[model samples]
Target: MLDLLVIVILLSLVVMTNRRLAYANETIHAKWLEQNLNRLLAYHTAFSFLFPLLPGDASGYWGFTLQQVTVHSNNMFDYFGLGTPFLLFLDFIPVKVMGLSFLTGNIMYGLLGFCGLRYLFLLYYKSLNLDILVFGVRTVPFLFYLPNLNFWTAGVGKDTLCFFGIACFVYGIQFYRRRIISMALAAALVYFIRPHVAFMMGASLAICVVFSGRMKAIYKILFLALVAAGAAVVYKQVLGYLRIEDLSTKSLSGVASDTAGLLEQGLTGSAVDIQSYPLPLKFFTYLFRPLFFDVHNVLTLVSSFENLAYLVILIKALPNLRRRDIGAMPMWMRTGLLIFLFAMVVFSSSLGNLGIIMRMKNMTMIYLLMYCTWSISRRKAELAARATLTHN
Candidate 1:
């Protein structure tokens, strides 16, 4: 009854805010995509929830230990220390309380993803001072309606958590300067959910602090030095938590090689020889593979088109990437883009599975999309200003 009452209230709010939602998209496709993605996630949850419930199930779905581990064991840190169990722990609640139905658990994830998306957009807009509602612009729709980002992230899994964590980190840094508690909370999310990403984000933040002209050199150096020391401590802690021994560079490469070998063998149909590629090539593949020619299915086909669209924007922006142009960019935007680029190179080198790649790309792609949007908006403002001056 309580759940039903909550749903009723949410529905009422949706109806009341229908006009505002319409303003979010000019066409119904983005709206429909959100609804459909939620339904798809629910259907997936319905099918997937059964695997763990069945006796002798050993498929290892979503990184959980089947029925043996309950939601109470989520933060047990010792038993389930590695891999992503936070999202599974979240799903466990609705399943335990509301009878494990798709409507209950998956709809909850759907709403979580939706909130994640909104938070992501807020991070971008606020960081760049972007106007999503520029009078005649249609480009904002792509940010909301990108199929792979929506479909993969709008589900009950680590992708949703990644989205939520990265968004929170960006928001905290961009908006709540000097607010250590908020930033720490956001960093904690990223650390627990994806520790390497937390490190990457921390690196970007430190770089931003060091290079920022607004602060005194001594202050910047002191802050950066403190941050670097903290990151080293956190890195050691993360290594200990994961129980991974051997901190040598050779061991790191071995791990990446072994992971690549498994991805090549395990992820049938999406396998590629990532082990053969150099680092730069791996980065390129990570950012822009599954190209139009590489499309083997409807999903990849759609992704190809999205890639093509973004590629055009990148091509146009490349020549304009002058030192002055970069200097003109907001500090947070510069930090976010560098973080995205660095994270992509890291993830791409380590991961070879196309499905995983598709899901993980959402973490960085939002920043790129926002950078493009901001660039376009800034150019238009410049043109409008010049026209006004000429007329005057």
Candidate 2:
């Protein structure tokens, strides 16, 4: 009854917000943006309710375990890291303290993920001219409508929190000086949830800051010093959490070996045999596999369609990867690209299950999607500008 009541209230709020935005809109584009947001939020809420019935970790582990966890439980930290316990503790508040059902907890987390998605939407809407169409379609809106993005994020797990963290970090990167607290909070959220990803984000930020030609030399040095100091503070802890001996090439090779061994142990039907593939092949498979050739169920079929779109975007954006074109990209896009590449390389070497791959990649795929979309749009705008100059 309470869950239903809360859902009613949330839906009402969504309607109210949409009506307000629609009334303030003077053009069709603004109206469409509001409508898209309203639809996205509604889908997110619906998925939050539907995901708990699906046969996956959210339903199997998180839904059950978080409900069972109590404030007095000593086993919160029984896992290897603090990530699980932190999430458990978070869900415990609404579930155990305020006596909400696990379903309600899922809704709350879904709303949090919605906040992250909104931040991402605003980031792109502000940075890129989303009014520009690609292939006669508004591509930015389509990116948000991908089922996997909402499915993985609108649940009770690390994916939701990590997505939120990554979104906050990326959105804050646009105006880092003004949004330092947001970036810091995002880093901390990701550090507790997934330390290696936090490190990757920090590394990506450092690379972007160092190579950004627009920033002053003094600002570059200051940012580099800050990144170096942060890395120094967390390097050992992240390595320890990951159980990696060191950052040597040999140690990195062991990651692939370990992943191979894990895959060979009673793997399920959705496991991909990428253990024998080369590094480049592994990366490609991670980002663009489980296509039509690998579809086994309705879920995979839907995912294949989404992957097909990503492949199309990649092809469209390939020309923009040239040195000159890349150099023209904004710092945030470059940072996001680096982070996406770093994460893809690392996780592709480590994971073998298709289901897990889909969920894990959601954290970094948004960046790639945004970058590719923006590059394509920017190229179109440039071409239009050139044509105008030629005519004038």
Candidate 3:
């Protein structure tokens, strides 16, 4: 009964929010946005309700956490490295104390993930002209409908929270002066959930602030100082979480090799043997594998199609990927690109399982997609301007 009531409330909120956004933004197609939102809501709700019944981490996270909470165990800090216990404790509250069903708790977290996706949509909508079609379809809307983006994030686990945190960080970076609090909160959320990712975000922000010509020198200096101070406070703790003594190249390489070996050990069905592959191949497998050749199930088939679309976008944009074009991008976009590259470098070297790759890469795929789509649009506009000048 409570689940049904919450679903109704969620539907109501979605309709109200969709109407408000459509009314305010004349460029947005009301029907199209509403359809997308409704589909997204359905995907999230369904995945939340069904994932725990499957054989994987979803069941472990939900079942084990509930058991711990019900038994009044204080061992929540045992798996602090992956932030598993933290998420488990979060699951405990609504399920044990508030007496909500697992489905309800999952739906609630799914809603938070939904908010993150919405933030990502708005970021692209404002940053780029989404109406611009790529390959005969509007790319931004189409990208939102990708199944993996919705699936991995619409569950009760680290992926959902981390996705939300990254979304908040990227969106907030666009209007950092006004959205300072949001960015700060995003960093904190990710810090507690995935400190290494938060560290990468901070590093990216620092780089952007230093190189950005739009900000005044005073502001640049202020942010640099803040970044340095924050790094000082958290550097040791993050290293501890990562279980590394230092950030030396040798240490990082060893860590990546060890991680890849561990993940590849028992996961034969889904594992791709990339440990001995070259660096470029590792990155490619991380970002764009499970293509048609690797499809073994319905999920991988959908991901293959999505990845093919992304590949098309990349190929179309490559010729126009000039330094001048990149230089003209907004600070937030550049920061996102940096973060995406950092994550690819870090994870590609360490991940060996395609299933885990799909889930983990969800955090940064939006930035890559946005960058590609924006590049294509910008080049088209430039070509149009050139043609007009030639005509004159």
- Predicted structure with the largest TM-score when compared to the true one: 3
Cα-based lDDT for every prediction: 0.59, 0.75, 0.75
Candidate 1 regions off by >4 Å? 1-82, 97-100, 126-137, 177-180, 216-229, 241-266, 278-280
TM-score of each: 0.74, 0.85, 0.88
By lDDT, the candidates rank as: 3, 2, 1
Q: Is 1 or 2 the stronger prediction by lDDT?
A: 2
Model 1, residue 297: distance off in Å is 2.1
Report the C-alpha lDDT of model 1 over 59-97, residue by residue, as the tens digit.
232335555345445343333333345445444445544
Q: How far is candidate 1 from the true structure (C-alpha RMSD, Å)?
A: 6.5
After superposition on all CA atoms, what RMSD does each candidate show versus the true structure? 6.5, 3.8, 3.3
List residue ranges in candidate 3 displaced over 4 A.
Answer: 21-39, 43-46, 65-82, 130-135, 248-266, 389-392
Estimate, for each residue in 1-392, the C-alpha lDDT of model 3 and write its tens digit.
Answer: 76678767876887678667655553546676666766766766677776565445555566563333344454544434435566666665555455666677677777878878877776676666435666688876666767788777777777899989888888888777698998999898888887777877898889988888888999999899999899899889878866899865445545555655654555556787777889999988988878999988877888898888778878887886878876688887888888888888888877778877887788888788888888878878788888999999
**Model 2 lDDT per residue over 1-392, tens place:** 87788767876776676667544542657677787778878877888887787554454234435333344453434432445556665654456456676687678778878878877876677667434554466766667877999988887788899999988898788878899999999998898887767878888888888887888999999888888898888779867855798754345445544644543455456787767889898888889877998888888899998898888888878986556767877777788789888878777876777777787788889889888788777777778889999999
